[model samples]
Target: MTTQANVDTRISEPDAAQISEFLRDHPDFFDTHQDLLAELRLPHSSGKAVSLIERQVQVLREQNETLKSRLLELVNVARENDRLSGRMHQMTLDLLAASSLVGMLDALEDHLRNEFKADVIALHLPGLSETQLHESGAENLVVNETLKELLPTPLCEGKPQCGRLKQQQLDFLFKDQAAAIESTAVIPIGHHGQGGLLAIGSREVNRFNPCMGTLFLSHLGELLSRMLQKHTAG
Candidate 1:
């Protein structure tokens, strides 16, 4: 038989799991036992004892700091998005004001080089020979049957593609500038790819990658196709 002293000691020293489960079940227990909160101590990383209230305050402070950091990051992203939108709006306005295909191409090239930071800009319009485009004052324009085969399935479906290009594709698109280009964004203009395809090449190998966002590229292609249609109608 256990003595009264043993019974008292057993009641005071409950199993760890029992205490943990009890606390987990009764989260507000400390709220009711306000004095016990101040009495409880936790081992500090500095090998010193800290009051439970102090430890809780430290944890809350750390959480607050983390939240502030994330908020700042979100704010920076929003500002950057706003800046990009402003530039894209300006570019659209410039494109809309173009009176001819030459003007349109000039606006496209200028905005892409200055705003989008493309190192090399090349265009391939099918069915139109280089001589025909050159006669129309578009000497930089090109045409190649291999361009159709080089386009990825996404581009065939009228979507933009971003990533490193094969040497053959780069050579066909950039031509003389192929030696300098390391990556490229290939954007197919028009729904059926009749308008043409635009290639924006970069010297940075990782600048255009498969993971990059293509929303801007898609919108740019649509705008270009519409502009080309106007030029053709004129």
Candidate 2:
């Protein structure tokens, strides 16, 4: 037979998980044993012992601060989205007001350079010949088979290709400006990209990261496709 003292010594102390489970099971345990809050001490970040209640208050304060920071971030994102929408609305009005293909191209170039912060812009449409486009006043906006090849790839589907492009891809799109462009947004224009493509180059590397959302690009592609049809038909 084991001695009573030996049996008491063998009793396992509850682990942190066990204590957490017990508290979860009996939320009202504190109601009955409120005095434990004063007796129990916890190690704080400042390397000092604090009563359980004080530690809990500190934890709650930290959590409250984290929540506040997250809320502010969400607010800032919402404001940015609102600003982008307003700019898109203005661009649409400008596109509608354009009288000809050259007018549309000039309007797009102006908006991208001045308002949208784009460093260089290139457009490639399949139906129109290079000579015709150049005569219409579009320089470096070539009509090429590259647009057809790119549309079938994952990079140019509904999602579009963003961020740093490969050496060959950059050379084909940007030409002389390829080395200067740190990042690019390649929007597939027209149905299944049959109409062509639009490339917006930026000097900043992070301007078009792969992880960024492409919903805006998809909308832009659709808008450009429709606008091109209106002009190219005439």
Highest-scoring model, TM-score:
2
Error of 2 at 195 (Å): 1.7
Which residue segments of model 1 deviate by more than 4 Å?
1-25, 35-50, 129-132, 135-149
lDDT of each: 0.81, 0.80
Q: 227, model 2: CA deviation in Å? A: 0.5
lDDT of 1 at 145: 49
Candidate 1 per-residue C-alpha lDDT over 112-208 given as tens digits, one digit per residue, 9 for 90 to 100: 9999899989887645556547844332433334545667543456678788888887887788889999889988788745677788999999999
Instruction: List TM-score per model, in order.
Output: 0.75, 0.87
lDDT tens digits, residue span 124-154, model 2: 7666767657855433433346644643342
Number of the top-ranking candidate, with lDDT as the measure:
1
